[model samples]
Target: MSSRNLPDDKKLIDLQRFQLLVNAITDYAIYMLDTDGRVVSWNAGAQKFKGYTSEEIIGQHFSQFLTPEDQKAGIPALALQTAETEGRYETEGWRVRKDGSYFWANVIIDAIRENGRLLGFAKITRDITDRRKAEEALRLSEQQFRLLVQGVTDYAIYMLDKEGNVSNWNAGAQRIKGYRQEEVVGTHFSRFYTDEDQQDGVPQRALLTARTEGRFEQEGWRVRNDGSKFRAHVVIDPIYNAINEFVGYAKVTRDITEKYKAAIALKQTEQALQQAQKMETIGKLTGGIAHDFNNLLQIISGNLQLLSAEIAGNQRAEKRVTNALAGVRRGAKLASYLLSFGRRQALDPKVVNIGRFVLEMEDMLQRSLGETIEVETILADDLWNTFVDVAQVENALLNLAVNARDAMDSVGKLTIEISNAVLDENYARAHVEVNAGEYVMLAVSDVGSGMPSEVVAQAFEPFFSTKPEGKGTGLGLSMVYGFVKQSGGHANIYSEPGYGTTVKLYFPRSTELENCVVIQTVENIVGGTETILVAEDDEQVRHTAIEMLTALGYKVLHADDAQSALAIIEAGVKIDLLFTDVVMPGPLRSPELARKARELLPDLAVLFTSGYTQNAIVHGGRLDAGVELLGKPYSREALARKIRSVITNSIQR
Candidate 1:
């Protein structure tokens, strides 16, 4: 129905119903204000919100509900003027209640005009303090979190978008990746990976794994902005929103280059220690076997020599005995090589300038290598002195030269370099068996077919040879290794396929003056007429020794062990010399027997013989001071010379 046709009473009832609806709202203060901003009408909601009764607040200016600052700024009047002219006004600010308390409020004003004439205005206000406080707290928490992430410097923490592009970077990310935040943001995260890694889709796989499995962690090489690479430990976690939807990834990376290198060095050292232990075990077994074999060779050699004397003038018999003797000598030489590899042979060390010694042997080395091999010696001007067995050094050099010649297929340059070297702690740490110290380095290099890593690993092992069977005994390198180690030195070999090979021996430097003593050769095997006491554990060795000495015109005495020999010495027997084996079964050791026998016979001469000294009369691979020693498996001539030499030296002393 049209408003003009409706009854006045019905219109009044409709207006009253609208008032009741507006008054029922308890959350919003609903009221009316005159054009001048005076409170002309108030509702129940206004009384509840402002803590005021209708009688107390009626006719009061609406400005009374505004804060003092807002009232002074004339905001209430402006609000009313805006509503009258523009029809409506809305704002949010602090408003005061009747009790003088302020609350954050949302306010609105609407003009109620009749026929374009000035009229009152309707106003509404809502308390919004709790919501404002919550929003403020959230903003503060986000700021603090951003600052925390930016302050870290040890780890690269960053955020990636859903498509793996960098969204945000922290200070740690800038420091570790060598890039500024402006340079990294909006770029693909794959740029931080190596080209190989990127080609393998490692970055994408990491993101996918994190998205599917919740997290991904790995260690690998990472490229920085400057293009340098480092070992990195990385972790990726899929970021999720409050509703559990995947947004992106949170990546963290740490540089672990030094730690990774240290781990690798430790592993290499462990492998070296294991190899050394294996070699040591093998040395012990070979040493024992060689010792026993030497004893048998000695007996056989002695019997053959005696047989040769019996078959004098008989060419056939003499030739047969001579061939047998040659066999025994070869067996003895084989046993000696084993002892050398085992580091069981006694050494006669002398201080020598290695450069001069090598120069003197240049002619011999040249002749040994043949015309096909070019020999070159690079000796340092002021090379250091080392205490070592001169004969053994010569042998070691010859062995290395021959090996180099063979490696070069008999047609390449062989270089021998001698120089002073100092090994530092870092080298010692990487090589477990090496000691950090000054050393005289002897390096031999060859331009030949190099060895692979597997072959180089077992190069020093006895019987491990690359040469065809029967072409090599395989003890050349092993003997050199043992001799260097026994002389308190280190041996190392470097080789690569198709390149070349170099073997370096580092001998401890010595401060002693060089000794150039010339050893006189005994051309004639002369016998002596003196009482000689032979003490040996093996029955055959003892009997053979007694017969040989008796044949040499000496009154020979025999004893099964050191104790028996000592008893005979204590019985006041006038003995010119004591020939005793170093290793015996009796409680009275050979060394002790020698000491006691010398005490009883003040002018007695002593000679020690051993297939194995077993550290009894040898210390640090050298014979004890003032002790005379003769190695086992000696020929008749050698036995005669050594016996006579000892007796004459003892009588002279």
Candidate 2:
């Protein structure tokens, strides 16, 4: 079966069959070249790829198929020489067709030898233009995708291995996580998690969830390379290969610390607004009730005064009347406290330096707190002035001191500090009812029993107290809250279970210079003979007023409402003073009635009275300018003094 023993014709047939097989291939060009680099044989594939017939291509130089640049560089000659010397040569480059077009080709040259005699070379050329183009497009697409991921700066995009180790890091990852690519790659992804999260196995859970569910997303606290923490919104998507084989994870993290803080502030502001609205509703209801109750107390008090005068000679009867009057006075005090909590009490605000004002009340505060309590005052230099009622301020301070005394069991220190302050926009955003501006700050701190958070939250609510039953009215803090709000101020209380308490009151700064304080001397309670017109809506209150004025030796005329009083004035009644209730059930208001009565009589005096002003004669919680007002539930002596004072001032004017 060896080729040497076979017949020459059989060998010739076998060689012809081999040539036929090589020539039948259409993908690779098969051809042979002489030692001089000229083509000697060509196949059908050579003809098809080179755009020439075998007869036309035979005997042509193989360099004709090479590009001009390759020809000029002698690459074809070098290839032939290398193949003859080294037995083979292979390369890939652009080749020219017979029609002058170009195609990417894989060329291989093999040395053909005949037993010590040099022969031609065998060359194979494959047109791989499609495969080359596909490979190049794939490389370019990968490069572009890498560039896109690297250019982003807001989100930390990175890759993690299946075991949750950092595999690759982009520029965005470096920027957001504060780590360079070299610093993070090959490190555990858990390093980016906070210590608490890591201890809770959050990082491991995230990877497991993503691998099983395809994706995992969450928002939480994350740590940076520098150990600083931020609120991060994170997403992890399990990566897969073309065949759907699980590979790793693609992680994206966004720093949302500022956004998170803003959301929290918005929620707190909403809660504060709700609290303010609730307090406002309660205040309205309390004010209305106090108004009506004060009217009833005034009727009882006025009638008791008339009976006291009639039974003056009977000691026992006089003593009982005195006790009844004291009871009425207590009721009136209770109503006054309710009015304060409702912000309906009339205020006489004046521009004064709060530091000096606090100093003036130091002695009174000391006396009220007794010897067991230690009082201290810290006044800042150049303290700002505030417009407020001096009497109310004194009352507020006294109330705080007394509460502090009771809290400490009368054995603690009370500190009152006054200073100028400025509330910025940040503070205003956190406190919905507060405005950003200059303020006069008055802080009262006590080294006594401290309140918890729950107590502090309810401290401003009426009837919410921590003291034992009957030990407190529970309106002290509520009254302070309403007064501060009515004066366009803010109050804040800070306390802990065992750390004592501090209450800060911020009043709007006053730009006006301080005014001189007016001191009024007490006048004797003497009745006047001046004719007075009493206008009251309540029948019992009107009758009580008439009886009191009659005993005071005044000629009193009575009217049930403002319209009736106006009619009497229009009828030319000789009236020296018009004592009118502020709120009336008539079309004619007390202010309008007083205006018309003055028009009819130039020297007539007008004195307004009310249990609650109801904003009729009160504006900004203060009485109107040049208007005289007497609060309700007054004693017989107070009515006499106010009436005499109003008439005497009118006659002088």
Candidate 3:
């Protein structure tokens, strides 16, 4: 410790060199302490590291450099005890410097003894602040990661033993599996599987696969504690020790019920879109056929009307004419049904007072549903009026009544309620194609045997039926769905097994317009003559139309194609009406021809005819809102009447 204590000569030179080497090291505080614990020597390294000069700290007590807590805990005494008994002591502690700052230090004290007596202690202290900080940071980061994993409520994060036993569970696992940690830990992971899955040994296979292949991934039904099944995406990973020996497994399970539902919904939507496209195509085809057939019907009806007028009081002929008129009406109904399927059902939207509508349906519901079921109406007064096709809405209500009657087996209470609704952003976000606005809510509730969850899910899927074979067509709700959707509304169904079912239809509120009114045309109208242009692709129908028009006394010019018809018009043919089929060849159609012909002859009355009405030309069997058009399969009388009407309407316009 002192210069006088140094031995003389070359071996002492080696010791001096070693001391010089230690003093040059700034990372460690290499110094000497006296037998009584006083700091005897401080090297250049100690001075630089401990913020002290030899003059200031040489005679100070070594405990003075330790933190107060360490000193209070007798850490200095323990160091001295180790130096005495084991000849050295090593430890890490917070040690102070001359500047009153502290750092994490690794300290080693070695007892220096000679000739069976203790002279002093050699001490070495290294700054370990960076290592300590790094360890602390790593520990904190791990804690945060654990918290993040536990906080996930959408996924079940847990661990399993190598034998597929549950070893750990997080909050997320508890929330998803409906189990507390105490109820699930140490149990076999197979408990999460459905009965069928468990019987199939799926859980064992999953673990086996994970152990053999290092990982296993699957998606299927997983049971909850309450016995309900959820669609889940699961992954199991084999955890191994450093020697690659399997220790346990890490299993992550996510309840993908919403995601699965969304996927199914998307698939259904695609199918619906494809079906819609197909229906549109069919509509166009049927419409073309109907258009031609209609011209033929016009010819027949016109001649029959003329004959009926001329042969008045001939009972046999009169009876035949009445039968024909009745047949034509039935045919019109079939065409309308087809149009509804094509979403071309004519929509005559009006601002409807929903309360009044529901009230109006109650008597009909009572009569249709019978006395066994009580019909209740909860009509909210002054509810926002909705722009809707009232006749379609009434039909939809009747359809719902029939559905409820079937569900309830005709013996439960049916509630039809109308109320003002405010559809906010949340509702709009949850239901596609819905917007935030005021709506008129027409809710139908039934206390019945109720539908299964799956049935409720597909309640509005077209052609999806649960009724016994030959009992139902499954188009009732689909039509309701289409009608409501086309009217700018939303529909929702809620049902649970053995409870009841509630269906809500929301139609956007109309700011103006009022009560639905059916437009009336002349009933039992007779035939008339008008110069007409008949454009038809079918030869039989074209020839029939020409004969019918000529017989009816209309100077007729005929063309089989829209192009030829246009050429006739271009050549200054004085056609009073442009009568054409809706679907035509080339780039022109009945509607397009009418536009061109009307330009050529401004006073020309245009009439469109189609077998099965469609969106492009007709809506719900009526002409598109403002278009004066006629549907196909018309009788001779209807044809003549429609021509007269169109011509008369043209005059009025």
Candidate 4:
């Protein structure tokens, strides 16, 4: 606009004042870019944001304000193109200043069009670095809080809807409330309060108090799902949204019944027995947590494997991702350890030769322990066969070796011994949990620091660790104990303050001979052009399986449970194979679904998979006779091979 074309002097002065007002603004960068994205005009606000004077910045390309990465990616050109074609463009990203420092910024570019002709672009920028950092920290804090709530086992932590109905329940909630998720969710939370409390409308009062004052806490008797009564320490806190409106309530309760009993015992005795009594509290909770944790790890591993194939360049990034994937596998191992601790894991108790198992693990033990630590194995001749889950035993063995290594510190001797023993009636009487039987004993001894009698007594308790926090989850020995007990055996730890520690696990001797090892010929994992039905309760797993199957030239029909799978099968579609999970929510289990499917199509192929065997298609810790099973965390290759193999078996039959 030319000043000579103005109407009058006063109006021109008013226009000058308006221009001065625009230049006076320092909080927001206001500028104009030519048709080609070169700076055509600048204000004082631009100098405040970019630290560049108008004389120095005019005619320079506006891409100079963007970071090198954005410049290299042609972001400035895209912004201009978008603004010119679509009227405006807005986004948030890192912006560089004249001093070369970067600041997180919010930017907007609008096309200055007249008579449908290209004129210039009006641009604005604002610094939001502090706000961005605050948001990131808040996100991380919320994540940590969520994980902690999910991991709580000592208390029932849950959320209630506005009207006091249970909205969400954690493992601890089910453990303490004695109600499965299906029963408690959507039900009024007052069911747990005593009749007197319910009559007094205690639940409503608590929610009201929390909503008004931000929190409410009390100690009273709460009824279990079985109608039993127990004293509970309860706290209710109002949950609020970002706008400060009340959304719900976070309820946490701890059962102090067993703690009251521990009050009569000595301090150390109470501390040790505290968790042991609480074992009943985690009955179904731990198992479900372990299974879900394993499934999560499987998903992570599967995704990482898939990602590895896609990233061809950048060795540094690939190596970092690979290392992270390895850490995830270690986490998976930990989850496996937890599953054994819960005794919910499916077992394949094959008759294993004790001597052979020990000898096979010797090399691994030696490698795991440094050269300073001496590794010795005592293999008894004619060692009895034991019916045990081989994978669990391997996990237990590795755990024991790691513990021994940690105890040994600089240098020590570790001995692994295998022997056959018979527990008489008298011995079984002393150990009430054990039964008199012929047994195969596996003992690990360490010649290093050992626990005192007090510590030894609580060695098998979960989270009972002498190590510093973050160094241990204290589940290793507990896992060994749970596995041994679940396998119809016993675990005993002998330790002294001065001498050392010897941990022994006794498995009932098996009359059956050692299992025969089968070696199958390797073939390419290629899928057929046949239709297959996939039944899985997890949405992500089900979708991933479908995608992989469809990619492999197979037509996939999927459902979230066994009942839906049955419906698909009874629909009369030609299904070449039934791929299903062992665990589902409905009354129809995988075994029943497969049975019905087989009845419908006698030669129909079936393949089952799970993170842990849920005993649906398994009997006595092993897959049912003539059944084909694939363990979870399966890769595309494993899934392909298993499906092809099952289908081939059906054809041969």
Candidate 5:
């Protein structure tokens, strides 16, 4: 058996078996190229992976598989030269397959030299597309999970550096830690513990336990920025970077004082059982109806916008489209009112100098009240910043002005006065359920027919509008009332039937300075020529998107489903961005499709559009972090801006 490694015939048989084994492997495309990098030898595996038969690829250059960008950059030539000179070359990149779609390929090339003379090179490539997609999916999932944890308002969530310095803060963290992100990051996290705990090295012990045991949990008292102490349930989890290197700790602290008291108080009986049942039923009904109605509206409204943009030069058609849009807007407002009355969300409150905000709106108010109305602005000296939802505040002002106009028969004297006000305990007692605090007062008054005492008392009640029948939806003042109360502020209406009406909205003062506000002027619509993939199941909606994007100078590829979209991606059409519907058919959802597409083309951008988010990318009525969402019924400018923004970000990437 060891006689010079067997006879020559036996050796030839062994080599043939080896060749068959190599050619039969389907998972990897194994083959050989000539000295000039031309495909000279091919196998079944190569035929399956490269979408080419031996006859088709035998004389083709191996560089054909490289992406356009790679080929343009001379990567293929360098790969061959490197393999021939350096003995071997190995790397990963996008490789074109038979149908022209791309796949993430792990490739290797070895120089083949016989008798000290260069012959050719042996090349091997494996499709790692699924592997790459899985990794990307995991990354996006982790990011969204982090966003969900950070967006928690009931817990103080933050991070500390390895040395126990605070490095991040969430909204809840700021509310609990009594510090802004600028004040907390880079500071010692030990400040969250009580003085006694710090003295006893609790912070150090916590970090050590988290690092060693994986996590630390305890109940303790923590101090706030106002030098106040509050009981909290705290947990610290050790964070590690890739390769398991120690990074820092994720800290989550929950305020349990009010929660504990509420649990105890409500343990025995449900006082609002009937009321709660009614509201729950209403919410469910409203949600179901809204989803269906909004879906139809999305198709109609979207097409209308496209049509309007297309018929911009036709006078009658343009006028009709404008009227149609107004109707759609009214319907949309009604839908908003229904949702607000059912499952309303919290106000995104910010500290704003109301004085400046009012001044900016003066021109708009003048346009609203017409020339007959005298508008006056009495701004207070040394204006204080108050925390409130700026948009809702503006809406409230506009509502009051309109009501004042209606009361005055479209002509009256309107005054907007801003000043500082204080609410003492006495005032709190007079206004039940109101807390005493220093507030920024925003008062709107009009010398018109005023409301009676009874009418004023019920002004803030839902469905209690005093406007003539067919004039209002009755949600204006009600919305204002809810906004003020939810913001930890107060709204008071004072009126004399014969005199006039004055509404005072008090927003709690804040220590933070006012943030600068930007006023955007109308600008010409921006367009792009980027290639966009539009994946939508609805034909009308898909058509509208294609038309709108095409009108904006973008080249669009349309797909009716996620599978078809992926097919297009796999076939390797050059795509700049993926504009997909968040909710789609089949197992390959939009988010998952995005992951797969990104695997094929890492620089490909993604934008999600939906009529209703339906938990696809929106969490708690807010878009997830790092996600760009364009809600249904968007205009041309909105679409252009979002697409352009995404493409710009991608270019930088």
Candidate 6:
């Protein structure tokens, strides 16, 4: 027979084999339903899957296998209608089994036809409950990740297109980058960088890095919408499709401005604290050296005075003695300067008109500066008077003049101007340790090559100078700084390269117009015959003190430390006064020793001394309330005066 006119034997054999294969499978419910929804045929798969024999299940209604809800909702009939119209209907839902229990099933109904006439439907169903649960879990995980990203406010999480334009924005992006979605979306991300960075093509470079290397990270200054600057940490990551095609980028940014500021402030505070500690250490060292050196000077001056007296009436020897006295005066001046720098020298603040003081120093400055340097003065006629140590001011000016001359190579213009001004609260707030009040401003401007900014910043640091080695001590500006601060004043320097420098010293205005009251020297005082006790650790200082007190008409008792002083006072040998150094090597303190002596003998007078005593025990060379004090290295005259003062004061008590 012709193949087109009759069925081939090969096709007949394939149909039988397909039927046999369908009957052999039992796990899948394979069956058929007629156009009226009746079970017309059932294979072994149907018999095994539904737990029914072909003889009992055939010719039964297909609706019996559907859930009650599916039946009540007409889902099975609707599915059959759809399959009849569209040729197939597929879905997954609850389907009934032989045990009357439901299983999640994937079902498909495919309409069958021959010669364009409806015949039946082929149905296939599968158990897929685990797969449905896995899909649900995956959906929940994606939701959680979205929430996590949205809650982050410190980081700017967003997306950018391949062209580097913002394609997405989150709350974090709006908060950190200071841009609303409407403002930033579709705009290039380069707008977030500073103008300088943008000009330098940093944004394009970042994009290139991300596209070429898959990621880019950087930290630097960024500008906000309001034109403020912040330190930002940024990351850009290139995104790609599943096919490995370049898609876009995801960008994240964070603001680290507050953290940066905190680090800088911590560094500044640490430096300030270190400077304060150094100053305290130097103060103690200065006081010790001054006390020891003063003693040596006293011996020299004293022996010389005696020698001059013993060799009286020799004109040549007298002239030599006069010159020696002048040298001794200069040595004393040097000691005073050291004491001033140490903040130990006594200051006699006097009120003087600022204008007149500048005028008075004009001639001295002109002579000291030489004819090569032009000296000019500007003094306000109605300037206010200021309270300060006149001699120290003169020295400070001289030091500044010498500095200016050196900076100019000995030829420059030195201008000294005095004026009255008021420092308001705003100004005081920016300055360290200064208050809002009236001030007398003394400005010293020099036309010479100026220092660099870095050098100017540290100009007041102790032992820091720019002059050639060995030519400068580096203590001039530091001394000026310390003295001005101790005198309730402020000092600052301003310099610009090639534009010269100006140093402005501000002294608090004085309410008092009277000249300084001179303090009486020990020579003008008298000694007393008080039984006094002295306590000192240094043997030389202790013996020198005892000898001076004895020579000044006082009965003296000596001790090496505070503990021995207490023992002597306890013995009750008519001790009229207790003299002890502040710092001792024993269990007893100077103050404690004084307290004990007063407790035993209520009439006992106390005088404390020390070369390295902290300021806690004394203020501005004045003793604490209800106490008497004599500083170390005292001479016979100083001892006499201190003894008389303490005794008279004790009598008054």
What are the RMSDs of all candidates, in order?
4.2, 4.0, 10.0, 36.0, 36.8, 7.4
Q: Write the per-residue lDDT of candidate 2 for residues 1-653, one digit (tens) a residue.
A: 98867899999999999998998898999988999988888888888878988778888898988889999999988998899899999999999999999999999999988876888889999999999999899989989988888998888989998898899998888888899988889999999998899999999999989988988999999998899999999999999999999899999999999999889988888887887677667668767786678889899999999999889899999999899999898788767777777777898788999899899888988888898888999999898899988878887777777877887888989999999999999898778679999999998998888998999989887878899999988988878877887788999999887778888988899999997744442388789788999999899999999999998899999899998998999998899999999998879888889888889999999999988888788898888877888888989999998888788777767
Which pairs clash in the backbone of model 5? 101-570, 101-571, 101-572
lDDT per residue as tens, model 3, 1-653:
76556667866897889878987888778899998788988888788778988889888889988999888998888898889789999988788988899889999999998876999899998889999999989999989989998888888999888777788889989999999999999999898998899889898899889988988999999999998989999999989889988799999999998899789768766765876687678557555555555556655655565567677998998999878867666555544544555565657666778788778778887998899988988988678778776788888899888899888988989898889999998666455457899988998999887788888878776668888887877778877876787677888898887888899999988888675544445566454566788898877667767776677688888888899999999998687888887766677766778888888898888887655444566544344555765556665666777888778777766
Count of clashes in candidate 2: 0
Q: List ranges where model 5 is wrong by over 4 Å.
A: 1-286, 308-315, 341-351, 386-389, 420-439, 461-463, 482-490, 508-510, 517-522, 535-539, 558-629, 645-653
TM-score of each: 0.83, 0.85, 0.56, 0.53, 0.49, 0.67
Model 2, position 568: C-alpha lDDT score: 95
- Compared with the true structure, the alpha-carbon lDDT of candidate 6 equals 0.78
Query: Which of 3 and 4 is ahead in TM-score?
Result: 3
lDDT by residue for model 1 (1-653), tens: 97666899988888899989988888888988887787877788788868888788878888888888888898987898788889999998888888889888889999997778878888998888898778778888889988988999999999999999999999999999999999989999999999999999999899999999999999999999889999999999999999998899999999998999899888988887886687677668767776678789889989988888888999999888889888888777667777777788788788999889998998999998999899899998788899988888998999999999999999999999999999999898777678999999999999999999999999998889999988988988988988898898999999998888999999999988898755444569777789999999898988888889999899998899999999999898889999999998969998899888888899999999987777898799877877888888988898998888788778778
Scored by lDDT, model 3 comes in at: 0.79
Pairing residues by index, what is the TM-score of model 6? Answer: 0.67
Q: List the candidates ranked by lDDT, beginning with the highest.
A: 1, 2, 4, 5, 3, 6
Residue-by-residue lDDT tens digits, candidate 4, 29-109 = 998999999998889988987899999999999998998889889899999999999999999999999999988999999
Those runs of model 4 whose alpha carbons end farther than 4 Å from true positions after fitting are 1-280, 290-295, 517-531, 550-555, 571-576, 612-615, 618-631, 635-653
For residues 483-526, write the lDDT of model 6, one tens digit per residue: 78767788889998788999999999987774644433445647
lDDT of every model, 2 decimals: 0.88, 0.88, 0.79, 0.84, 0.81, 0.78
* Model 5 lDDT tens row, 318-423: 9998888878777766665555444342244557999998999999999988999888999989988987668768878898888788778888799999999999
Full ranking by TM-score = 2, 1, 6, 3, 4, 5
Stretches of candidate 3 exceeding 4 Å from the true structure:
1-338, 344-378, 401-415, 444-449, 468-471, 496-502, 515-520, 529-533, 542-559, 563-578, 586-588, 599-604, 612-625, 635-648
What's the lDDT for candidate 1? 0.88
Runs of candidate 2 exceeding 4 Å displacement: 1-50, 61-66, 69-93, 105-128, 160-216, 221-230, 241-248, 305-346, 517-527, 601-604, 620-622, 637-653
| Worst 10 contiguous positions by lDDT, candidate 4 | 260-269
Q: 23, model 3: CA deviation in Å? A: 21
- Kindly give the number of clashing pairs for every candidate: 0, 0, 10, 0, 3, 0
Q: Candidate 4 local accuracy as lDDT?
A: 0.84
